[model samples]
Target: MNINSIKIATVTAGYVAGVWVLCSIAVVIAPDTLRYISGAMMHLDLSQWDWEMGMDTFVVGLLAWSFFSWVTVWCIVTLYQYSLRSFS
Candidate 1:
């Protein structure tokens, strides 16, 4: 089967936005948890971790993620189309 790249990109962008919203909410609610996780993952001191969240940050992240996701998905779709032709 074939797929529409634009539609897929829209869906991918929306998924990224949704994930960013959830992550922002999580950070807002339990910033300390995020700080601890970050510190553990990076082997850094929790005191050095700054878990900050705001509307401006969320909007900027959402926009960036949406654009990045759309472009990434578009590239994937293009590669898939190319591969299909190679196989045919």
Candidate 2:
């Protein structure tokens, strides 16, 4: 991709990562909310449920996905630029 395309992709990935991080905060503060939404759509009580493998996993996954996406996009951009400079 060209520099412009890389810039756009990196910016979009960063924005998505920021949003994901923000939403992940809710899981830390209110783990039960995730259970209600994920376990069932009927607002089922999940206080008895384990947060380590369930809600915690979801939160960690989101944060990890966000970070990975942003990093990957940036890496692609760097590689593209390097290839251009090396080949030309």
Candidate 3:
């Protein structure tokens, strides 16, 4: 089945933004849980990461991630469509 590139990119951007927002909230509510989850799954050490959370940072992060996610998914979808066109 063929996929709509823009639709997929939009959905992925929303998903990424949602996840980042949740992570930001988790950072505020229960830092330890966030740290544990990141450590176990992503092998990231939250403590070592130097980041200050604030309104500006949150906005910047959300926009940055959303844009990045959109671009990444758009590229993937474009490549996939191109391959299908070449093969079929």
Q: Pick the candidate with the highest lDDT.
A: 3
What would the per-residue lDDT of candidate 2 be over residues 1-88, giving only the tens digit for each residue? 4586566666767788677666567667887777677668666667688666466776677667766777788777778888998999
Model 2: residues with Cα > 4 Å off, grouped in runs: 1-3, 40-49, 53-64, 67-88
Which is the better candidate, 1 or 2, if ranked by TM-score? 1
* Per-prediction TM-score to the true structure, in the order listed: 0.85, 0.45, 0.82
What do the candidate models score in CA lDDT, each in turn?
Answer: 0.88, 0.72, 0.89
Q: Say which candidate scores most in TM-score.
A: 1
TM-score of 1: 0.85
Sliding window of 10 residues with minimal summed lDDT for model 2: 1-10
- lDDT by residue for model 3 over 6-87, one digit each (tens)? 9999999999999999989888887677677778797666766644779999999999999999999999999999999999
Alpha carbon deviation, residue 87, candidate 1 (Å): 2.8
Query: How many backbone clashes does every candidate have?
Result: 0, 0, 0
Q: Which stretches of candidate 1 lie over 4 Å from their true place?
A: 42-46
Q: Please tell me which model should have the higher TM-score, number 2 or number 3.
A: 3
Residue pairs whose backbone atoms clash in candidate 3:
none
For candidate 1, lDDT tens digit of each residue in 25-60?
888888888778878899988876575577788899
Model 3, TM vs. native: 0.82
User: What lDDT, from 0 to 1, does candidate 3 have?
Assistant: 0.89
